[model samples]
Target: VSCIARHISLTVGCCWLDGENQPHMKAVFPTEKAVHDHFENLLRILSYEPLYAQIRIKRSNDETVLVGSSLIYFLFIVQMRNMDWLSDLNTTLKNTMVSIIDASINDEVAMCCYGVLCEILTDEESKDLSISDNICNYFLQMLEDIWNKTKKKYEHVPIMMLLKGFQTLSKNDSMQQETAVSNRIHIFIEICDEYPIAYDVIWALSFNKDIQQQLRSDSPFICKLTQLSRQPENEQMSKIIDGILWNLEINHENRSMTDKHNTKEFDIMISYSHKEKVLCKQIYEELIKAGYRVWIDFDQMHGNVMDAMAQAIEQSNTVIMCMSEQYRKSNYCRAEAQYAFQRERKIVPILLQKQYKPDGWLLFIIGQLLYVDFNKYEFSRAMQMLHNELKVELMAETHTAPVRPKEDSVVAHSTTYISPPEVLRSSIVSENILDWTQSQVQDWLLGHNLRQLSRLFAACDGRSLLYLSKYMKNCEPQQILDLLEADSVRRLNESISLIELSSFHSVMHEKKKRLPSMYSSNT
Candidate 1:
């Protein structure tokens, strides 16, 4: 019986591969009975200590090892397709797969191991499998090793696999809380600079507010994003980078507003069924953290429910319907949608559940409109899509008046126009200050007084400050109290006149013109 089972397993493994390096294809089982029998035999063999021991010894031989590894890889591929199979896998089978991942010399075998591990960790149905912090760390280390080996070969398959694994792992809140996972995410962002395939992984990591905060604090990562944004060929990458930057900027602005007095209207109103409040609240928190002023019933405890809901939908610039089966059934949610529609507000439909489809009245209202799929990508990627949409709407609504500043005010003079020091100070103090590109800073500082420009240049380091000075020819200034360190920022408390600086420059230019002629005549 043992000999026959081993032969059948090898045959099944070979058929599973289907002569392809990739293991995504279906196994060529001879019959329905054969498929059931093959898995039944696999479970029995993997559970039996004596049989598994014999298989391990056989795996030592070169020819037997290849077949044995293929068999294990095949099992993983099967498990990925049918997560129910994982319920039958005992500790012995799980450990065997982990061992194969740890000990495998072949990249393809390792990739398969990681793929299965990801499936077990991420799939909702496979939650029985134990995935400890140490195990997660081991998987991340293995992924890094594979990334270093395969990144140069233009083999994005392994990196993509690893990213999928990371994305799956991130879905678990416990795994996300692990310090090791957080460090891995940071390292992965660095890897993204070399491998564009890892960008999606970065996007997944960004969904976690903690990870986003970490990225915001990381100067090098922000610099990498800024550099990538300048590459016209990297349009998709640029879009992701822009979304992250926009989120960071908006959050900063929102925090600043919150700290001070913010009288601005809500950017969005969230409507959903009370039954789906958990998901709605999660979306609400994410939106608020991303910097949008969101109005939801959770924050409106003091108001009349119907009246407040109507007022919120009417006042908000956009209404986001958290579309789900429950939402469709809710009368209140429908009323909010109708009011937003009647008010001619921009209504963004977001599909909250994987199985949710708009139907009947809800379908009539939102069916014609394009919606962002929260279930399609990882949460952060979907949030980014929604954010990009909101950003576009916000940009469209931003209309600057043609009114000019008074002549005596700083804005009247091209060279002496100083922005409120408080505004510049706030930007300089922001965690995302480094995210500002050179061109953006230049644009902001344009037409400022020479001394203020000098002070600004002094705040930056050597080369950048020198480069900025070129734009300061018609600039303004406030005296620098102290020279700032390369990485430090200090607010200028006092303002000074640009008249002295401008006169000094004029005198210097006059002297320079006469000096050349004077030297020539003397010679």
Candidate 2:
């Protein structure tokens, strides 16, 4: 009906169509609200028309006014049409947009504009969509300027915009200018530390094949930035890292899929108290029989139980905590359990003792997790249930969700780097801060999964990020990358920036002068 009215209006030209009176013209809408309604109706009809499609900004009084975000509303449809259409929108217009983004006073409006722009740029409606270098640079410069000037005010929003802008830039194969990308990334990481939005930017940047490759072959900036970003929300850092590993595994699986090779089996460490060792052993043996390798730490540590624990947990598929009478009573078990819990591992607790419940204060510590029970001698049934559950959970966490390319499966949302929502918004508070060892950070990251990492990062101090960075310098690049993941790297990226802002960057560099650079001549 709206389309028919619009078509009749166009045919009649400068005339309003009437509902009755036999194809007669009616008076124009007198009120603003009525005019808005008529215009919105017209826009709805215009959206379907081939030529007028993708027109979110309209010109009527010789001014480019935002229409309905209707273009972005139908973003998928527009994206399906042709991304080349975006390139045709005139570079001058994009430049004007850059100016508008810079000059805008209303943060809300600026955010809306930013959203619209990002929606268009990252639109996945078209397979071969391309964004131009000049436009990307314009947004990048705008973001950089905002970061440098508004560090004290609106500290976080800029980095998110910068990240989204960079995402579009990163997608441009033509824009693979290594130096430019690296410098932008460096500045981005720097700003992320001071501001709360670093995670989004770093997360987006890590998706770029070139950026990922460049990061691997690190220079000093990359090494420092990588360490810094992995510092915060150690738990999130772990998830982001796990997400990366999952991606790598998916890639590996794709390469090996055709050969019908057996899926690789992995060992998981079971850390329990001596009293629960029998139950733990039962679970461990069950896992081994089900085709999973298992590791159990029964006795006391020889040298560094921390490192040994870290190594064991890092190699495992999951960490099984036998939450029983002995585990609840032993501080050693609880401490080790907490450490493994922080590493983003798939933790399964076999509830053994009905009398042993987490305490009142530990309620805050334990959250609302429901543990599997195996307190009785129903060992066989419990073992079978554990095997099935472990198999499913392990596969889901480790494997990428299969994709149907022809159907345009939602762009593989698993990021190469992931971060928690909190890290992108706030700073580390005093109460949450804890002085932790490097080995501790590694164990925390390698042992837990994403959900747990968010809580751990939230509970950490700013110093912990730098501490982790320094500690990680001793580990191999692959090991570090495996532990940090892209999301964690992003957090570390921001942490580095915060340190620099506090003049702690210089302090850390001075403090760690003896540490060998990952990007040094060794590469």
Candidate 3:
């Protein structure tokens, strides 16, 4: 602790103006003894009332500011040792850190102290082990706010130090396991935007067995990063930025996504049929009035049935599938079911009829996962499940998971619906599969007009058709079906972007001698 105290000013090269034209570095601390005294006294006070200690340090004057360093080290020790102080310190430290950040400080000594303070305060280790929902939530938000405020000025030690702090904070199993890992990653990516240099800290930590092992669970972050990593270096960097933004938006959205329809702020998509529309719309309005970014077919799909539905589904954080008799009777509902199943989006099936049981493929999915039974109209309990799901998704996206499929992978559940054994026989189709180009797929999506998707969906029916049309409005669904039905080579190529084609193809080719011939005629 004392060594850190003396090394601070010297390493930072503190300086200030005087009467001379030439600038000069400021004087180092008076003595080693003074530095030790400075550190010891502060820690003694912090270990007393963690919260109050932070308040004193944050509100102190220049003469008393040394308490900041003490508070910083105190938090570090608490985190490294996995002490009980963390739960209490997390709350008080967050409040103190915010206040200190907002306070004006012109002195180099004070700034140096601030840098060390942030470095210790934001340690990801602090987030580990003991889970407290309120503390994790507050800490996650603070890290995000600090990252946004400091990213542009990352050259400063204080800012760089904060990054380290966050890295340590993320390592704490208590905090890391709490679901803020994704948020931490998001903030790191946001700061690293266009400048990969900033990723050094996280990249290093990512190699840690403890960190990587913890992040290996199933999560959307894993899927998103895998997808982002395969893009061209330039685009990969940009997508890193996008990944960060996506997590932030998702985390923020989760708060309301889980709330009851009457209380939720966002308008979530309700994937149901005309019969379930009343109940579905009720949930939708509930989410909307509560302050969410809800997407329904009525607002945007009018132009193209398929495109609208696809757009709404893709844009939504949650998809409520009302499982009523009418819902199953409609092919449209089945199509919507297929779409949600493929995307691996959050799908909550509310079984309205007592006799109806989700079986085969749907049962395999919904059964393995928990869902709300609406046969008896347990509105309150159903809404609670939605809230819990929303929270789980947010946490999952924040921490990078290993099993979630990357974007380049075949649409997750596509294989369930599109069987390749039936489409491998045509020679022209087989050859096309071998020749099918990813560049062609990119060109197709980029070239097609998004506005025309609905007209093409007119041939299909239901919510699923609507969902597809929304995203692929420019491309004809028949062409997509045709492409999908072709040899595996063609389908594989279409699934990934041209920029990522070579690498992915190489991986696939290494695993198998000849690429499977599946869907080609559609291309």
Candidate 4:
């Protein structure tokens, strides 16, 4: 019986029951009855537990151990595929799994026990079992054990499963104490070299606000992670480091942030990543020399910095976003852009990444605004265009009265009349997308959930938008965004006399790609 159970478990569990593939597999084969049938058969097999499970007596060692190990794999994988199965499991079966973990002396049986425990305890809604101090301590103890075995080649699968439960488990009272959270953080760091997934565990832990605050207070810990980010082993590792750094920024000592939200602020508020500090500083210097008051957080802000940013935005007239992949990744930067957008403040985005463009939340925030691409234009020219959009008058057309023929001119004296070319008015909203005035584009954006981006479309009619969609059909999502941004600024230059260059929304062009092929036929 044990030999048969082991063979069935190996074929079914390893080949047919990988957790990640189950969701799509179930969707394709919508026969839930098949899984229910498997569940019934598995429970009947578990009904015949060894004598040791009932009376604490030793059984025929290897045979019973193999059967028990294979049975628990069945439980774990089934629970993964149908999570509700764990909650439906009876109280006796639940205790049996935990009991196996508590008593198993063999490493194979112990690993299977950990796997089942991970499936069971990770779900907080499992009414039969909630995590306690014992369970939390067990995960920490096992992680410590893994770290302590210097020369042993132990399985890292159990460690990963334990971290999954520990992640959800850390939210309850069992992990409320600072020391418990801190210890897990340390152990994850220690084991990260051998088990690189350990870094992911630490990153996940940072999502809890309280734990994020705790990590921020530990200056040395934040400093160490920052150093690690500088020399990441790979792109995935680089993203992990960026995510951690984005979450737990540094805390400057001996300086409590004052209530500057109500105070007098600069005319232009500069929001950029510290990675672009040199460029940000130059922008700040030039703005200052031009006599425009500016706000750039020259001193790197660390902890609890959003409040002052809100206040600064409230008092500022213009916000200059020095955008890059790094800036978009920061929660702090996103918050600032979002708040500025919410207030309907004018935004001027200057792209900093070589080929990067915004997406998701960042994309929505800068959608309809004038985009200044530093990568495409020379520094002096980009700044000059930025100034023209701001109405600073560098190469800007000065509005003047139209020159008319003299009173005695021959055309003026003649009775013959002439007709001039007809131009579309900015206020007109066309039925066709191609003939659309920019103002109509603004109304279309406002009708959507995009209040942050409603300006800068006064001159971009349906043809401009259609061409933009066709031109960007093959480009990446990011490239399309940046290209459209540069195109928005180019449109702004033509309408500089009447343009305000105010900011936010960009989903329309992307949605345009999905339009019927007939829409392309009109042009």
Please give the ranking of all candidate structures by lDDT, highest first, separated by commas. 4, 1, 2, 3
Predicted model with the maximum TM-score: 4
Full-model lDDT for every candidate = 0.51, 0.42, 0.40, 0.54
- Superposed model 4: Cα runs more than 4 Å off: 12-40, 47-63, 71-96, 99-111, 122-131, 150-182, 207-221, 228-239, 251-523
Error of 4 at 465 (Å): 46
Instruction: Residues 444-506, candidate 3: write the lDDT tens digits.
Output: 222232112212222333334323433444677567546534532331222223333233334
lDDT of 2: 0.42
TM-score-sorted candidate list, best first: 4, 1, 2, 3
TM-score of each: 0.38, 0.28, 0.25, 0.39
**lDDT per residue as tens, model 2, 312-378:** 5544456777764335433345445655555556676667655455442123334665355564426
| lDDT by residue for model 4 (13-98), tens | 45334554555445533565665566556555654546334322233454554445455545445445333444466454566666
Off by over 4 Å in 1: 1-51, 54-59, 62-114, 122-131, 150-160, 179-182, 208-210, 227-239, 246-523
Top candidate on lDDT is 4
Q: What shift in Å separates residue 296 of candidate 2 from its native position after superposition?
A: 24
Candidate 2: TM-score? 0.28
Q: What's the residue-level lDDT of 214 in candidate 3?
A: 40
Q: Give me candidate 3's TM-score against the actual structure.
A: 0.25
